[model samples]
Target: MSIQSILDIGKSGITAQRLALEVTSENITNVNTPGYSRQTTIFQTSFVTEERGFPLGTGVNVAEIQRAYDDFLQTQLKTEASTTGWSSTVLASMKRAEQLFNEFTADGLGKSMQEFFAAWQDLTANPQGQPERQAVLARAQQVVDQFHRINGYLTDIKREANQSLEGITSDVNESLTRIASLNDQIKLIEIRGARANELRDQRDLLVRQLSEKVGITYLEQTDGTLNVSLSLGPPLVLGNKAAELSLEPDAANNGYYKIFATSPGDNTAVDISSIVGGPNNSQGRMGGTLQVRDSLVNGFLSDLDELASSLATEVNSLHSAGFGLNSSTGLDFFTAPTVTSGYSGIGGIQLAISKTADIAAASVDPVTGGTGNNLNSRAIASVYDKVLATSGGNMTMEAFYNALVGKVGVAVQDAQRSSDLSEGIIKQLDTLRESQSGVSLDEELANLIKYQKAYEGAAKLVNVGTEMLDTILGLIR
Candidate 1:
């Protein structure tokens, strides 16, 4: 080989080794950086020449730097992330609702119901006393107030869930736009035969974040761009462009939102609300929130309505049939709904009799062919045990409410267990992913030493080439 060729080989070795050292240094620098994938320098032999019957080897060339990536592992991570997000969200809200209905609390519904019935029993003992009559009114009002408070709190919880949906949608949109931009940048760099490792890492991190908000599927195209979409719906990002999701008010309930995804191919927005868990099962936070608002909170409110409506209906029926202190008749203890159906029981119910004397404690008055008795008062107190049709079978109001509370407790426990399981799965997947792609400082430090020695050796070869060239020049002179 010519001396000039020998010099070129040494120069190439020096450059390749230096680049390797630089990559090792970068890995060490970003060891603690989140979502930073470890990169390795790829070395390729430069062009070879056929001399006589043998090929002369050239020094190494620094090829593209490759990131440690596993597509299947990343996909699994995204799925687990979505699951964890969904379960955690549901568990948190369910726990919050459970705290409100805690039977251990003094102002709980069960306690109020008990006190209300006790007040009626007190009035049954002193049927002719005004103070006992006032106590019944106060306790009755307390019961209604408890119902209203629970209904109001549940409504507020549902509203908060809906408000969070807007933020989730906005975050999803931002991720889509950022992914599209990264796709463009990655494609540009890759087309020039370079690896955009950092960009790819950033894009993958965003994809995981997006998966937490809503389930997503992604594909890595040959052109170094990612095509992303909802797991069960339309494409969200394709090449350098991204499809947008728009929120419209639901037709059935204007307070809720119907989400639509617009595709670039057809430019038509398709309603994906159901598929995304609007009223269906979901694997992400958005689905969890919808479940809380539509199912959990709504179910509790319905039970409260049934309890209030049934209790009021039976009490008013017995009280109205009797005579009050002033010989008043046809007066309801609690206002009954005019319609048979579609009544929001707790919200619509009120005390029909404002005056304390209006309470119908007499089934008959003995003075004028009527008995002034406490028979009706005792009957009204017994309404708690009256197995109304709303109780679903022969269960009393107290038994029905107890069952409801027990059901909510069971639901909360299930949610918490699911969240814990999801977290465990996500933790395992994350550890596996980190082992594969995450930077290891110890490994990088070891690599730094090896590359440093190789760099030094390559520099010595360049020095030898310089010495050899100088010797050849001395011989020619």
Candidate 2:
């Protein structure tokens, strides 16, 4: 081979290896940067020439700059991010709900109910004592106050979940728009036969964030664009256009917010709450928040109202049947409930009689003390052991209350377990992804050394080729 050909081959090798070294350096620098993928140069042989019908070897050229990645691994990460986000949100909300139940604590409903019943038991001892009647009234009021306090706290929990839902939906919409813009950039760059490796990484990062807020499914098109959609709904982003999500206040549901999605090409926005937070979905942060507000909180409120209504009805029934110490007949101990918005249960629970003399301690109109006239107070105390009206008539008031609190505890445990399991899966999948796509300083430093040596060897060959060319020209001159 001619000395010129030798120089040409050496130059090509130097250029390719130098680019490889630069890529290795970049990997090392971006090792800690989020969403950065490791890259490497792909080398290929240059075109060959024929001399006397035999092929002459040519030097190598860089085919393309290829980034290290795996499609299936990225897909797995997105899916698990949605799942983990869901359970984590639910676990937090349920923890707040558990605090209100306070079944095991002294300041909770269990303690108040026991004290209220004990006051009635005290009344059975002195059928005509004015002080005992006054004590019973005080205990009943405390029980009523506790029910109001717990229900109010539960409403606040539901409100916070709604606020979180609003924030998550906004974030998901922002990510969708950004991903669509990245799709346009990637398509334009790849069309010109260039690698948009960094852009692809940025776009993938946005996709991961979107999935964490709302579960989604995305597919890559032939032109390297993505079509993104809700997990069970229509397209959210198509090519270069993304959908905008907005929430409308639902008048039918206590003016709570409902989600709506509008694509760039479509004027009408589709409501996606059913697909997102409905019973079909068990994914994403918004889904978990919606479940807390709509399902768990409401159920607890319903059970609490039943307990208050039943207690009031049972006491008033027996109290009105007996005669008061003042000889007044048919007087209810507890007043009728006044209906109110969001709280028809415990809002109007007040004592019916104004004075302690109205205490019904006799079954007859005139009680002369030694008769069996304390029967009405005894019946009122026994209401605690009776089956709750809404416990399917199988469980007593105390047993039913314990079960209601137990339900909240069970919800918290299930959410925590789900969050933990999903997090374990995400961590394992992350390790696997890092092995395939993430930058490693140790691996990059070794690559730096390898590429630097190849560049030096190519430079030495070029130096040798130049000297050999100089000697040949000197001889010819």
Candidate 3:
């Protein structure tokens, strides 16, 4: 080769070696960086040819630093990851609620109800005894207290769920703003035809996090921005812009919060409670809390009202139909006003037996109470049987509550199963993505050795060219 051609080759070789070293160093430095893809420099032959176009001399030139990535596989991974995240979040929250109810536990509400009924059975054995009546009253009070405790617990859970929703909304809004900022940055970076791979990874992670808070879908726009939406069909974030969500007190019932959305531009409020089904109507932990509060707790309250009404109606009716022990007077043992329906509100009801009994009329025996002429304990016993019968053989408010709690167990199990299936699908997708884009240490090490050898060879050529030039100068001297 001529000296000039040799010099050119040496210079190009040096450049190729320097570029290779830089790429190797970059890969080693970012070895532990999360989501970082390894990059490799492509070297092309720079050929010197004669007029006939036949290649004579050649050296290497660094072409492009290609990023090891698979866009299609990554997209698939992110989608399944988002779905898995959502299901897991919902399942966790539902499981927490299930633990609160503890349906099968001996100390749970179900057991408390059973004890109340057993107490009632003891009272029924001796109706006239004050101790028996007092026992019944105490047991009845215990049942009421248990109902109120469960009701309070349900209310607390509902409040907690609302708070969780509010927290999630705040998180979503913050994430949306961050994503918008990143979007603008990515657009600027990509304007010159360079891929913002690291920035894109950050954005994908954020999107996955956002999906867990609510059922969400996102679309990539033509301009390289993302459009985000909730399952309720409302836009959460649009491109580089975002909408805010807030909670407002319900107009009809100030106790509950109604979810509302506000635009970023003008802050115009749009009610989203109906769309998302409010805190209680949601399908996850929020839904479970709502069910416990409205249906489970309220149902128990209704049963209590029924028990009180039935007891009052049947006992008062029997007492009014016959005379007391006093032959001179005929009066009811307990009287106020009869409740027409089991659903009637509890008001103006009191339990009291008449103080006086007429013993003057001798037509009836006092020992064995008569139906019409004397005090009839049999009448009271018949009414007690009616109360027991109305309870559907269980005779206690607690028994009814236990039955309801059993249904909650089935719901929790279903949610767990769904979450497990979703997680499994997500894991499979993740493996596929990792195979496509994830860095392999063995592969990277091999690449490192190859690049190192190329760099060394290139540097050697530059050194040889320098020595030859020195030798030519020495010969001239």
Model 1: pairs clashing at backbone N, Cα or C within 3 Å: 364-370, 364-371, 364-372, 365-370, 365-371, 365-372, 366-370, 366-371
Flag regions of model 1 displaced more than 4 Å.
47-55, 265-267, 278-280, 338-346, 369-372
Q: Name the regions of candidate 2 deviating beyond 4 angstroms.
A: 52-54, 337-354, 366-372, 389-393
**Highest lDDT, which number?**
2
Alpha-carbon shift of residue 141 in model 1 (angstroms): 0.1
Which digits, one per residue and each the tens of the lDDT, describe model 3 over residues 91-181? 5545654554555356554554445445445534443345644554555455345544544554565566556666767787788788887
Question: lDDT per residue, candidate 2, 344-401, as tens digits?
Answer: 2345566677777787767776555554478888888898998755654578888878
Error of 2 at 106 (Å): 2.5
Count the clashes in each prediction.
Answer: 8, 0, 5
Weakest ten-residue segment in model 1 by summed lDDT: 338-347
lDDT of 2 at 416: 92
Candidate 2 weakest lDDT stretch, 10 residues: 337-346
Cα-based lDDT at residue 335, candidate 2: 68
Ranked by TM-score, the better of candidates 2 and 3 is: 2
Please report, in order, the local distance difference test score of every candidate based on alpha carbons.
0.82, 0.84, 0.57
